[model samples]
Target: MAEVNFCLGPHVGLRPAVPGIKRAPDPPESYSALELQVAEPPVQQLEVISGVESVQLPCRTTAELHDVVKVEWTDSGDRKVHVHSCVPEEPEDQNQVYRDRTEMREDPLRTGDLSLTLRFPTVRDNRTYTCSVYSRAGRPRVETRVELQVRAQQVEVDSGAESVQLPFETTADLPEDTLVVWWCDEPEPAKKVHEHGTESDQHEVYRGRTRMREDPLNTGIFTLTLNRPTVRDAGTYACRVYGAGLIFLREKTFQLTVKGVSVLLLCAPTAAAVSLNVSPNLQQFFSDDSVSLSCVVGAQAGGQAVKRTAGGQTDLCGSGFGTFDGSSCTVSGLSPSDSGVYWCEAACEQMSQQVNISVCPRNDFARCPFILEIPALPVTAGSEVTLRCRNKDGSTHAVYFFRNGVHIRDTTMQRVKVEEFSVSEVQQSDEGLYWCSTDLLGPSHRSWLSVRAPPAPPPPPSVSLVRLICLLVVVCLFCICTVLMVLMCCSRKTGNKSPVAMEMTQCFGEYDDIAAGISTEHDF
Candidate 1:
């Protein structure tokens, strides 16, 4: 029964039930307001799938087109993708021509995942390629780009006069259709003295000095060696290739220099014998008359002396008298003019010695004479001749005497006293030559003396008168006798001498008295 029961004053008690919407349970307190939280997928990373970082290839090769190509692709997005294909094609979509020959494969794309696979590989297929992928979540498609290269074997050389090294490398991915050509630059003007590769292939200068280093198979490196280097082998060398209607080349250059070796000389003194000292008291001579000189070497070993001349050429003068061991020499003849420059020289092994000579004159008593003066003396019989002798300057103490040139005695007496040297009792034997000499220690002169007799009184005038008278008488007689003899001789011969005889007889008596007068005078 639907009985209405009055409950609390608000309404009668009648419950309506619903199956799904019974007043929804009050929302939980924790979720009273809207709070949205979104979840994100892991970010993708980029990676390298190709082995090469960068590449250089010959332009002449076409064979790269079909070579088994390797391509790399990476996922760098916030989501995963499934790779569909990596396609290689010409820039103008020319890949269509080789569609049937193309092949590709890829690895699953996860976070940081990258991978590659070969297409239908052949050398002729070398070209740029592309990688494509799609996301499973209906995301945008992902794609990556790649380049295919074609290459020929390349070699480069650096040549020096002494040696050469050829640098070479091969590409594993080179197209089968590529064509390679080997070449070298034009050689210099120098003669080919050496060859590295072979006489017909590679050559260098300096004969018989070539050496080469080549790896087994000659794939990567080749070098040429030489013994001696020269200036001629400097230039550029190259390797070239021709294919695909194009030319490719590689080259290198070398520089060089050369060197050599040399010698020199030197010299010393100007003149010959050099003067050193002057003797006989040089100082006593004037400056113009004094002397001195010396000799020396201007340069030591490896040198020569200068030639000197006074009027004409002369031999080189050396100190033959005072040479010491041939190294040092001295000379002792000096003149006032010799006081100038002088020099001496030694062998290459010895050093040079030089000196200047100075000459001054001095007064030397030991070399010159000292003179003395003597006074004259007068003496009579039994008297002495005292001769005073002294030096010119009167400074000398000791005195000496000489007779003629002979030495007599030496004394300190200034005045010579002699009591004897006279004729005693007036004897005639005492008269002779005599002289006095004085000593001045050197040369001395002598004084001369002459002895004479006193004159006799004139004959008495009275005696003279008588003698005169008698002399007259004798003269007359002598004349008479002479006449007589003459007359007698004439009478005997021819009786014609009367006048002559008379004259003779007249002179005879006078002649007799004249003879007696002469006898009387002799006696007197």
Candidate 2:
């Protein structure tokens, strides 16, 4: 058994520190009845700036050990910061405050790198963290401690305010020669907002705009005051304190944002360069058609993020039938199920205006009476078309109509049983997005009206010029033959009329009449 001896006098009640152990160490390895020495674990100091994404509490070992059980990390308040078990089947029992924000190495036992990273670290995480390693026998085998100090804050204000205050205070008693400076990252190079030391070079813009409550930041109350705040002053401002010889003591970072002019595109109308447009951009489309929607973010330098919410399910642009590229998403072979609301998110944390896309079901509205009855097919020009606006229930209010999002007509001045109305001999110009509504049902779903061109009239048929000439030639030959035969008989016997010319004109007229009949029959 090892005999534990305490140092006499002042060190009697102190911790486990090796006897005669100083800056140099060549202590005996094994402890028996003879005198022995055991080294004390050192505490590492970590100075982290707040407002950063995260900070790491490092604990590592190079010595070889065996039968590892678990590694636990706890804060000064005895709250569990992180825990990793060697056994793979156990569930994590982390606190709710640090549930999804803590992460550790996968295999701490093998690699001996038991480091805990705290995400979105704030001033609340500033404390001492103890890392303890246990063996398979449920005994602590190794221990180490770390002290973390987080520095920063966040401030938000509205534009046109008289003055804004970046508050910073410390309970630690600072030196008289301490220098405090508030730096802003909003400008090109880092600019000093307020300096409380000897005269130094200051930016021209903030010369008369900044001041401090104290003359020299004597007791570490280094708060800054800026006059006439504007949208250009929105950025990170850090208050850094320095002691004698310019030694850094503490720091607090502030994310200062002035609203009104510096707001996101989601709600503001000042973003004139950005545009969102849709192809075949009508309010509705027939089923089986393809829809292409695109957004141009011009100078806004954020990655593209487009989302569609349809049928109570939200999906990104790259899933299902939608395909995404730089700033656009395309969905082809659309159906009624593809109808939804879509919007895009810019990298500046700004969101574009939402768009509603409707993939019409080609007149399959047998289920609900809450839609405007549109023509299933295109109506011909100069043809009467009937539109029936369905309602959840009937009403006596006059039906009002809208075409292409504009009020164009109305009907039913008296009490009408039917909630629908019709239009007669609709011109081609009347075809557009149409909707009907009454005082009770509000308005029905919008539908598009299409007009087709009217058919041309038939022309009268005429006889062919070549056929008429042929008929005349054949008639002349027949008449000449008959006349020659008659003249021969007259010479042989007695006859008095002009036999050749007698029936010539009459033969021509008769043939012309017959030709007209033949042509007419062929045409029919």
Candidate 3:
């Protein structure tokens, strides 16, 4: 079965089976200590996938709102989504498209939950919806805005996985004459991945590899399973549902990625002070493609020399590495040995930051019509990353980008060369199986982007408290020993002394005798 996820908070790591837009919680009631005054309402965004059945746009207030207040939800375009009041309900006031699809709780004003429930939401429903609470006297009281995004369904899988499920389900019973069709864009024309009725028209490559639920008509779970998927199987897949007389009901798009050898990369601090730029700035390239490398020095001096380190050897731009005019290095007919880190060195031994260029072993461009450009190494998080849907002949075509089986970006304006899609401030969620395509140029091979956290700094030197205590004990013992030795020496010197001159000891009477005894003991 196709997995469904609803995330209205912080998201990290892998993308869900289907990804939704970002959302934030409602702002707290700002008029808490005020005397029944309204607070400036802040806008919050909520994300939900259209195929995920339903979603909630939350709006709540702690203030004592009036019981007879009216609650209404409308889009930024002034389209009404829902309305409720103390008067008779007018369902006709809502937009025709949202007439039966929106819902609100009974006496929503009394409970202070003015949230709106949008069902079976699709791309057409993506908009900023405002929730307003009006006083009984037609004065504004509390207003909360919610921006809801309804994204397409997506699914991703490893190339060697046993099976992958593409989800499509609904609560409303489909018409008895409903027809389901599944197709993927691959091999020049669209590949017929599966159909509900018959297997005779199935493609040879997908004959025994596709299946669906048996009681799809009754259960409404029409998820498709592709068995033993391969790398070439990565592309955009669509599931179309039809009603009686072949009337189109709905269509869901899936960006499927059969990941091959994945690249996990992390960047390091710049070795030098120069910046390296690659023309057409692709992360990965096939062997024998021409590339222009420029080492830009912030100082911008005219006579500075540029250098590169690749294939285990450092080559000065003026040498066989490429034609170099001090600042730029242009290499034609790149090879596997040319895949290495490139950087610039200054006259005073300062090194600039290095850039890595990865060259895949297989030249799928030599066989296929196009190949996606990606880094062979893991990308450092928060850096800009560019993905190019490069044609074999470098002709410009309408290029599309898909991450983990979901369409993300497309360059349709061919007025200029728009085959490249650059992702700025790359995040971990942006990491996935990415492939590109064009109307004339065939689909590019899938490239898995891996965003890695920066390497942690080395810990400071540790001092041991136990060792410190031991040193203190040793110092005290040494001081005590020195004091005792001095005392003992003084006592021994007095003990070894002759009391006094025997003649003087006589002390010429009784006074002399007491003085002699005291002098022997006290050693004065």
Candidate 4:
């Protein structure tokens, strides 16, 4: 053991001056008797804006400390935020508010980056958080505290009445002496509409019209009531709550919109008759093409139609569609979202007419526009021909067929199918223009057909002279052979040998010889 002696002066009982006290030099001990304690690192403060997509809570360790096997995060209210362990491989237990919103590094033990990511951060997440690490032997090692400050959220409110009350509340428990101020539009320079403790310079417009209910400590309600709110009072209003020593606790902003009689007066109408019609009246469209719709406005029916006319709305066309003139709209490279009821309205009598436009994908032919199919032109007059009307999507409605722009007939099928009109033994009258229409939004295109009569074939060919002569020779030979046979039989019965019979028999014998030779040649 080693003993030390202090060289203190007589003034040691009082506060010692510099160089008044000294210690002995040599000590034979291997180590000092007093142990020095190492203090933990200071807490980190992180500020975040409300409604952020994500936030990262940092907690890092060094490379030499490889035994960091577990990380735990807990809120200031004693609620578990997240827990990651390498022990039993069981599921972690997290708070309901932070269940699906928290994530850490995939290989945290190796990387030493045990950072928590909170997604879709809200205002209620502002508080103190603790992150503690443990070794594989279940020994607590390092810890860190984080202070999270989230900025206030902004809200929008629209009112149609003359008077309105804007309500505000906070989750933080503030003290009784906290200062609360209501500011309009800009709260940085403090556009003080109303304040709790002190009198401030307020704008002349809101000096006597705005009031606040200062029950922040008891009921937590700091509602603002504005009397006779006009269009000029429509803007952002912020409620700033301050703690002791003028420290800002939290802020809440409200966007107000006041709609009164003055707004209605700007939208008043005039007295006149108006009518509208759409050109190139496309009942439906496809996504691959562009659409151009022109609204033709007239003072009366079929009287002096004009384009570029403004209607009740400031812009005549709606969203996803643009206007060159006030009355014409063009939608380029249309999409399925462009399908809706499009209307043109005039200021007089609120006159408006709607045209439904349906946009479909290029691959979806069933929802495409109507089409008309016609047979080949110049068809035979006695042939059966058919005309068909087809829509991309099948319909069960009655299909009407027209000829020369006049209704001819309608066909209704059991199951809604493509419409067809067939003409049996078609006449020349059926040669006119033809088209078919179903329940589609518009008429189908027309096609022309021409009917023609079939021509008569040529008469049969006349016989040649050589063939006529051959037929006569065959008849004479047959007669001669029959007579010879009769005469030979009669000569045998009556023993009568006539000259004419003998001559005919000689001729028949000669003819028989010629016939035999001819038959032999034909056989070869």
| Winning candidate number (TM-score) | 3
lDDT of 2 by residue, 255-295 (tens): 78788643454455665434445665544455666766676
RMSD of 3: 21.8
Off by over 4 Å in 4: 1-38, 154-524
**Steric collisions counted per model:** 70, 3, 10, 2
lDDT ranking from best to worst? Answer: 3, 2, 4, 1
lDDT of 3 at 248: 54
Question: All models: lDDT?
Answer: 0.32, 0.64, 0.65, 0.58
Query: All candidates' TM-scores?
Result: 0.18, 0.28, 0.37, 0.27
The sequence of per-residue lDDT tens digits that candidate 3 reaches over residues 234-265 is 77777767677675566566777776632111
Better of 1 and 4 by lDDT: 4
Please identify which of the two predictions, 2 or 4, would achieve the higher TM-score against the true structure.
Answer: 2
Deviation of model 1 at 410, angstroms: 99
Angstrom error of the Cα, residue 159, model 4: value is 11
Candidate 1 achieves a global lDDT of 0.32
Off by over 4 Å in 3: 1-38, 62-69, 85-91, 135-141, 150-154, 160-163, 168-175, 179-195, 198-210, 227-232, 235-254, 262-524
Ranking by TM-score: 3, 2, 4, 1
Identify the runs in model 2 with alpha carbons over 4 angstroms from their true place: 1-151, 186-188, 197-199, 261-524
